[model samples]
Target: MKDRRARWYGGCAPGSRPVAAPVGARLLWRDPALWVCGGWQPEQVRTLALGSARIAVLGPCSATEHDLARALSAPELATVARTWAGSHTVVRLTERGRVEVLADVGAASPLYTVRAPDGAVWGSSSLALSSLTGGSVDTGWLAAYLRDKHSPASGLSAWAGVTPVPAGHLLTLGSEGGMTLASWWKPMRRTPHEASTALRHALGEGVRVRVSGVPASTDLAGMDSTTVTLLAAQCGPITGVTVHPAGVTTGGDMEYARALDVPGLIRSPFPLAARHLPFSATDVPLPATDEPAPSTAVWAMFADQLGTVASAGSVCHLTGDGGDNLFSSTPAHLVRLARSGHWARMFGDARDWARLRRQSPRPLLTAALRGNAYRIGRADFGRPKWLAAPVPKVSAPTGPDADMALVAELRTVARSAYAELQLADALGLALHNPYFDGAVLDAVVSAPAEQRYSARRYKPMLADTFADLLPDAHRTRAAKGLMVGDFHLGLRMNRRRVLGLADGRLAALGLVNPAPLRATVHAAALGAETVWPPLLSVLAAEAWLEAVERAPGTEWTRNAPTPAGAP
Candidate 1:
């Protein structure tokens, strides 16, 4: 059980580690015995018996042992645990003859259990439970939910038999087969008047917190001093505070702020007074070279052409010898295809297929691609007839730098196009740059072909937005770091292992096209050219399917079982 939980938290493969914490601390209680192995935080494991119950408390400092005690006495023995501190807790409760389990408000940790016909329960993940109980994971509901929500959050992991203790909820498993799941906390609802007050208060306080720690010599850049005064006056009182010289990038905001050793504040917003600065459009030229175009130039040109089409209100269709067409003629079909392997494959290709092939597929890449494509294609084209063209080309300079320039040009073009179409009626255009959402031409150019085509990668314009908000030194600095990569390194260092529980089932289900996937992997390893987006998407989808198959209560049988007495 510990090994399984560890594998899941540590990421079974290269990128699968737990998002919250290490498996040992994640699964085992930091306190005394009641040891738990394999889970992320000790609080995720709970022991409940008739007379006493022990639980690991993982979460913020605001959530404490006293809070758990109060929850245990609540009507449903459910409590909302919000750990003010960073780490989540493991909970172990031993009663005279029974015990109950509850997760934190955020479900940041992992817990799995299995129940027998006679009411004995065991397992950490549904996959583990399915193995123990000869059951299958049920993912139909999960699939439907993801199709609607774009994520598998709703307390459902990839497997069935294993159920996640929902965020802000509690779960109780008895010696019998009966189980009870209940919500302990719900979103606070307020009247319009209250909401307005809350918003104003929150904004004022947030601003104050953001500015409180700045050195007196800190310049407001182009901002007006009056706006800062007004914001300070608006905020009644300041509790936790921190100062950031420049606004932080949306991606690095949290970590950057944390690294500063500040508390209770987020990235600073542009001062209202600063809005008056004449927004200058500074075009940074891409690296120039007199050398002739290399073999890779053709693909680069094609990508640049596609960016031009995207800029000019046309959806570009990406087709490889063996991959699915990324941009379809139909918007709805395009979305579906994008959701599958189309987008990821493109991103994989753009990031350099060889590198992508060596790495397992990342769903975040898929989401990023789909998101960028939708933002660029839908915003620029909007069901225009031009999208149907077999191959669209823009008569622009075919230099290596063209791709980057095209993206910058596209940003200006897209904003205008969207304004003309009144697309703002459907989507709100914020003061911050739209390129922040991974919709920039340079990001596409620098990315592998698959990634570039899929429209996922960090956009320079978005980075510039933060640059505009930060001190000149930090603003000009390159190298946006990633927390996940660090976490992945930690997991790999732990060397956690996962059993091949679903390999055979995955093969039989035809969930993934193994031959192409293997080929792509081999190609990547050998530094050979390969189509990335399709291959990645196929691989990710297959992995997801395998996860689904291993979930609890899922049955892959072709027919219903016969009656007990039937032959």
Candidate 2:
């Protein structure tokens, strides 16, 4: 929901004076040994207290008192947390004085832990925790992020000494200040038909809990958003917002968005003007994002859409961000089919895919016959030409090629989703992506690989599950909306602004070579087919550095104890 003052910081301190809430912060829940503080609205924070044990559920959740008690009494808390209806973070205090924090399955609701002399501290904002711990930027982590932007670095954040709780794991702190992460989740296994039923239920419940009798909004630009918009419409007053690019269009998103005919849904179409392009806001400081986000580089384009939603008083804004990663299958799925002795189906699918990409079927068949096509060895970590520093030997994904590829892609998309949430928060809007919910993810992953992909059909599983709700024009749509041209045009128009970053933070820190970096930016600005991810990553990191420097820091340390009621 829309809560501009959601920035919060809280932690447990053993044998230390109780901390007073920050001037503008609201006390969520407090005890002698633990305190949680944030600028959350009263409705946003739900708590259950029982003697020495207590639990708090933050964000949108369908958790009841019974659920909290059961979680507190259960041997493993994450199992129960996984069954919750909507996206949320769970903070629990045990009678034994151990504190546990469970973040959502996605990076958007990340929790960070920092060790202090007195006790262990945790907070939602890495920037907030960094200030209290006197943390500086972790250049090593930044380098790793640039090298493996798709697969997020485990157990590290942008701030030095700030450890993020990995997704699907619980962060627990012992009474003596020791910390550990316990495995609490795994993908569910089910047949395609069973998974379709489970997915419908999970996704429907997820939306129901968040928007029941509330004012909400959803993006109507793609299949993912269209489905979410339809669901939200069944509940209460809902706004369907769409942003159509002003310049040369790519896909039929604008057409489908305009053609939508929902009985009660309010359609709001925004045309993104030419001035609202990436790199146009290089002169302006961006929102305080924890890490480098490529989306932040293009924040200028979405300001109007987000601002308009916030102004309309919509509590929550939904997007279909994680849908592609969850539903779309890669070439590795073909490998699975070939290994299972489905020769006819494998060859047929390969031919269909080859025709779409304008390539011969020989390579696809060869790759499928080879089984796993991934390279996860140390040699896989190669330094790019623009990078000046020695690349670290980062850990690579293991297991089957198909699974590893999907995990890596999901993690990458989660990071971007989290970045968008942070930016939305800055504009007084709470952004939600239900597809990232653990249950929803499990439902998607549990389905058979063959059922999830088809070269001829577009997201067949999603389409078939919600076929009745989809428009006839969009149900069989195959083309995807592309922003490549818009991005190129933005760079060309603001070449001088981009060139100013040749000797920027990354170059000064010796991470990237100024000469090669400048050449890459120039070529990209001229609309050459340049490698976009690494180039955008460098620029994103540069912009993040500038933004963090401009933002004010918050301290989470406790205030001194009152002097025997002398006041």
Candidate 3:
């Protein structure tokens, strides 16, 4: 019997209520051919059903029956979806014979689509889909993955015929057939002609909503006063974590953190030994995922903090990760002016910026001339010769300076979101970054360019946005601190493991040349200053491959379906 079954999966974390359909209890969910791996339930699944509308809110969300009803009844369901916030996916069956999905900014819940017998089936896990359809490796995706950056470039996964829905968009399949994809929220292209009064309220509420019942903690190092005050107000006297690097050259957010709290959770990693690898390295336990884990250093410092947070009875870790993007402006504003052929304005702005910085204006002019939209992601990630994959060209939208800024910010949001996801999954810790909220993005995008960066003021616009919260004194202190001692220490101690990882499945796949990869790892381990993203990516990918190949009843057959739109 050919089973044309449609099954759905969704859930939330911690307080999730477990629900499972008994085998053979529901035809749509019981088709053996259509379903596989009933054993792996990392978190209990939850489902909600309402009048002719079935909704499954998965993976830590505030998605409720009321929200679903509003979505089903409202003329603008996307708007209804927007008011709700969380790191999750809302998958629902409509009153009509239709299916729709709304995922948080850039597919946070990772709802991937796969080709099943009934037509196309959507689910939360790519591995589940691969097991169902006997899918194979996506070499084209591997080729694309070989290049630098970790932006959510597309809905494409590491397999063929599998795709994820993009962020801030709604995916709907109508009763009549075919998919209707629409954007509910577009970045505010230009600062509104009128000043937006919504930025502060939106941002404050954004911080408040991500809280769990447990006390939250965020790093004070490099944290802006706006974020600190907002978090303190919403979450109520949260502890802060600041890791001081252990070395002769020490630098971190510790200085600013001291101003925030006297006894904040200050930590210094126990120096790595030769046999010890980073907490996130291949030598450590790996999380199971359908796609390759991008290169990440979150675990480099964060793995230490997870234990402390957990011990303190904290339920979640808070971060102001997107503050810099949302609050500050770069010299790019000058370039935007030049690109628009406003020669006088560009020079004037450059001169003003130079005067404030106590430097020559010539460098600003030179940089603005060199400014471009290639989004030259991780050009720092060195290319290895083993993979002959062409880089995917991104067609960035050409528009006003404000739109460009929002686009750049969103691009950053995608990258950081992925990194945070990997870190949380690996550490088994919950996390919330208010700056990643949709409302915050809206607030930042609606502000005029003048507010983001002004020569006379230190992150003047950002400081002013939360003027009520940020102290007058703190507003003038815009200096940022950088830390790299941990990276050097972590890499130096893990060279052996790094070399061992390169010798295994990855080298056999020939996706990367082992020599350069090993050499890069070796040089970086010795603190020779080589590009790290590609090396870290290689480490994570190989570890993932090893885990996949070791699965009990599955083999990663090389010649799989080629995903459409892959490099």
Candidate 4:
């Protein structure tokens, strides 16, 4: 079977100006003002040239050539993206002689662009774009990353001058080379039943689009994965991979996975033992991704499962990533409710939430009133003690008032998943995350706020949407499995290597205070009260810097001849 995946880059130049193909990429198609190239087999790319317009939909696109031409007739990025059934990046030269690029809504296959002298150049890989622009890591962005690894710096890349085309937004270049962003996706308000129906349709279509008569695999542990796994089984044969803590007879995900007695389901259980712990192998080099992959920090834990999936001849692995972010609620919702004078609902939710956490409702309401969306605790308002310099202030993305916090969080999570996709690519497996699909998120968020979130019911909307397919016990289970013990054990074992990071690149760049960082690592190894996010963020940053420094030089761009009558 031909591989239906690709890594691509291209540029749209002014009339008759030439754009050179990047190194290691074969030119797929080229015209007078635009060029497309990729590292892919012929089956991976889809192209169409219609009246007064040309478009290239790269990476596993399911849209037919006729569909592309029809969408091109309208010449709107969002419309074109909507016409396409599968997740892919779109590069279109509009009839107005402007360039428009639409990245997938979930950013599962995001595109990055850099403004060139002639026009804007774009590629699937940020690192490649950085190399093309001769750019270095953006330390200011790094500062923001360290400050809030959970929330990515919106529209900013780790590499300077390389910007991610924000998810669901259209990147357009004017004739004279000016760039602009226009949002092409928005959640529509719908009744609870309408939203649920839309969600079910979107979810089912999302699964079917990826199932191409191939052996498929999925994580069958979490609520999201369980829902996805059972759905995939309905379409075709799929192996549901579940992990259970070795030597522990019960508890965690196995029980939930075992409950599903569906046909075409192959139960592939993997034992999570000491070998899969983080830092299990210190000598092995981590895969270099386009950005600092914090997921790589714990990649060892998933390697065995990936190997198992690979052995099963599964080409596409669907994960339930982005589901929790899509389905869960935050304190922001409470504040929104209070401002709207839904006082009774707010208090009820606060009381219910407080009961679950075994805390008083007063604190939750107080935190909401105070505009603290993260938590109601000893709020650390200033810079962290571990950082050596002041970080840049990152403003929240400006958007719809409803669930903007959750949207921001989901974008950040999707960016993280995008980084993890890089690692999966290195392993020669395509990671498909349907929950991150734009249509699915739109369907979920379109439901009334009350339907989307509830204190007494965990992911009430998600549970209700798939109630028939999922068991009540699996859907309503509030307890989540934590691998903190495994991580801490890794910390204990890799104490020296982690401590050495203090004297590493970040310390050299004055981004970290070695002494405090070392102290944090030491305390974490000893199972003391220590914050791991900052430590792990620093480690990821240091590892990225190390990888970037050691990576062999590559020229992603080369000079090509300008066309006749050009400047």
Candidate 5:
């Protein structure tokens, strides 16, 4: 029986595999029967017993082999047994015919089940079961898919007829084909305050735990080193914390140097000196000086700011252009942009070549605007090129009433755009992070009138949040830092390589005017313009599609997989 079971496990013909059986039980003939077990938690097990009668059990049971043996000794033990531990679910059947099932506390793992017409029951991934049940996949779920990007909890595969066994559920199948399903666990809820306090304590403890082994003392006395140590202590233990010394090539360093040269700009605005360090700039060589150069100093002061602006601009540009191209006046713009060919248009411009050759920032701004322009050809626009709507005026709000309305509108738009951008980021499109969501923008834009007058609070909320981590002078001043524009340098340095790939792909896809895209990219690279955010999104979308094509299997059919034998 054990040998037969092993072979069954190894190579059951795709659709012919037994859905459920007791561990080590041999299938002597082709019969439609399946056993399922799921939902195990600490000190508790949820199981499904199947055979002559199907039943589900939810309670604690010792996992000892002896306990299992004794439990199986009863006459009712002719049924199959399944158990869930952690994320793994296991099934075992006793000689007497009983069945058992098991699962874990968090229930992150999933098992789906379906009963076939011939009385055969099956359980596997939702996708797999859908294939067997002849179910039609649901594309509406794709909306939910866009929201979470992960498989759903309901376990309903995109296919119809297939259903997910709820997270905390167990099911048993009987010889007569009777089936039963039951819940085995329920999550407990805590008050918001309690949850918050617990989270705070956990975060503090986590920091201490991660930094406990580091030397209690260090020779570095500078604020930057101290701030870095503190940040490391807080975030390192959680996972994936990487620390590196600031290098010259980084945008943060360059930006910092520029800021220092401007009149009245001071070093170290935040309290923690190291918070200003630029870590996101790729492979910048550290600046050398008796006292570290102010540029380097500024880098340390604004390290956290280094990666955000470029990322933010990319998202903003994509959302705006994508929204306009698809005529999506709603948040659903990302879906259309991702699906239609416009994603490619946004990134196909070659204006970066021209921008790199210019020392002035104006050309860069022009390139940025042009890259973002939704230039509909005469064929696509259904009119002559001169008939496009005049640029809408973005008039400044005139009074408190107007300001409030404007602020509310901006907040709404920003939030809507942010959610879509986050979805794209989750899907690995390298878009902006959603940190600058509506709430953050609201706070920044609505600072006290007095605070707004100061040049130190440009991004008031962000400035305040890192005030303690930066130098004192920097904390009080407001300035819009131009991070996105700096991409021109990278474009210039790697124009040939980027154009080589971007040009051919744009031509092949026929999604845009290839000549203009080529011109934009080249113009931007030569310092005559800035063509990054819009262009990058298009490139990323193309890459993503190519990646999807290369993925194994039917490539997640736009519709869900159909279940087996279903009409």
Candidate 6:
């Protein structure tokens, strides 16, 4: 009987191999498919048991397996993730066969579960869950997916009826077969110095583990990667790469990458293929599920860069992906001030934010009064008016309106980061991010909101936090490099692909109307606002649906992996 359950864990997807038994989430087979979402990776599974209860820490974790087990066994359930310092997920099994799963606040490791009459099926892979149950596409989810072309604000996956264990929540499966979810990480406000101290410790430690005391290199895009490269060098000198924009895109990344002169600073040709006109899937990753990778064009370049890093004989690479979302928020922090009745600070912060962004304070104050209407894309697709998304369900944050705006932005960032994780796994390389580190996240949220956003002191924070790590010359070189120029080329080349979205699966599902979307593409071809991001996401979804249909087999029988793996 024990062996039978173990077999179930290994073959959740056909052709998947198990790396020994994992405790807790018994239904979650440690297969390759589930590793992509977050936390668990194919080679990073570790398990420990005590008496009857058992625990598994999957992905990058600082605690030794035994120490992690001891922490989970504490009377306070939150202790399980409280002491951990890296991106990971934890699952604990009780004597009664009940299970508990916990993911970090970033939801860096996504956990998707489906309940059946026999038992519950859970894993990190959304596509695997869909295949296991023969699930149909959920139109509401499809609506939301198109709505969130860039990043996902909610924990839900695209597969209908398959539930995502929300980030920072304790998800438990009772022995009798029921489940309960509740928040575990409680963030408290902190003094600026206190927050800085915590970050210094957390960020330094985060980079160290990924480096494993070996020399490392990081992508130098801006302050985020720049700070990380500097921190990694404290332990030992590390190299950096600048994915300089090739083609018509303006500004060079090398000026920034070269300034932080540590050791081997190489200029990699990460051209944002301005040639793939309309929308290039040329060597781009396909979405196997509803993972919203909004910036596909940029990602193609990132994918090429990762391959270069791997070939350079580096074991791990550091990233500052979550930096902006975690550190540099916006005036939205004022919403918390107003909500809490700190009227004086609210007014002051708004005034300061307006000055930094070079806008009038009146607009900032008015926006705070009305609350943030977080708009990622145009409200609806270019419409026959009938092409509409379901009214968005706003999950009012526990604090203030700005929280909604900031959280929404972070969700998109997380989705992009997760997509990059897939690229890393494909290249057999490890990527470390201090911004998403559990400790760094808790510390950032605890800082006074004014310092983070209201004053727009991102550059100052970057300088102050890692002052020792950064080079003196690079301190003042703060201009950002953007790929706005690449978009113009992408829009022209992918005109047909954009047209396909209007006439494709989305139109058939009533998720979009063909006529207006078709016109939008024509207008884009004629050099209007180029292409809309929502339209690009729809094309990404169409590609995924087509890939799913193209698969010759499901979970029951092995399907040949597509270009981006099983859908």
Against the hidden true structure, what lDDT does model 3 obtain? 0.53
Between candidates 2 and 6, which one is better according to TM-score?
2
Model 4 clashing residue pairs (backbone): none
Against the true structure, what is every candidate's RMSD?
21.7, 3.9, 8.4, 3.7, 18.9, 6.8
lDDT of 4 at 512: 82
TM-score of 3: 0.75
Collision count of model 5: 102
lDDT by residue (137-224, candidate 4, tens digit) is 8777788878777656655888899988888888777766677888888767899999999889878877876765777899889899
TM-score of 4: 0.90
The clash count of every prediction, one per candidate, is 93, 0, 5, 0, 102, 11
For model 2, what is the error of residue 276's alpha carbon versus the real structure, in angstroms, after optimal superposition? 0.9
Q: Write the per-residue lDDT of candidate 2 for residues 41-108, one digit (tens) a residue.
A: 45447777677787778777777778888987777778777877676788887788777888666555
After superposing candidate 5 on the true structure, give the runs of residues whose Cα lies further than 4 Å from its correct spot: 1-232, 235-456, 462-474, 477-486, 503-509, 553-567
TM-score (all chains, Cα) for each model: 0.34, 0.90, 0.75, 0.90, 0.31, 0.81
> Lowest summed-lDDT stretch of 10 residues in model 4?
32-41
Best by lDDT: 2
**lDDT, model 6, position 461:** 60
Candidate 5 C-alpha lDDT tens digits along 1-567: 001010111001123333334333223212233322222122323333334323222222223444345444544322222221112344444433433333322232333455654443444334334444553334333222222222121334334565544433554545555556665543233343343333223222322322333322111112222222333334322111122234433333233322332222222221222233222232322321101111221232322332332222211111111111111111111222333445543232222212332333333233333332211110121211111122122222222232232232332233223223222322222122112222222232333322222222233323333445545544443332354444565556656655664554324534334555567668777878543434553343333333323423211112222223211
lDDT over C-alpha atoms for residue 34 of model 1: 26
Q: For residue 87, what is the lDDT in candidate 6?
A: 73
* Candidate 3 lDDT by residue in tens digits, 56-171: 54444444567666666666657776655445566666566466677665344455666444345555566545654666666556655666434333445666676655557777
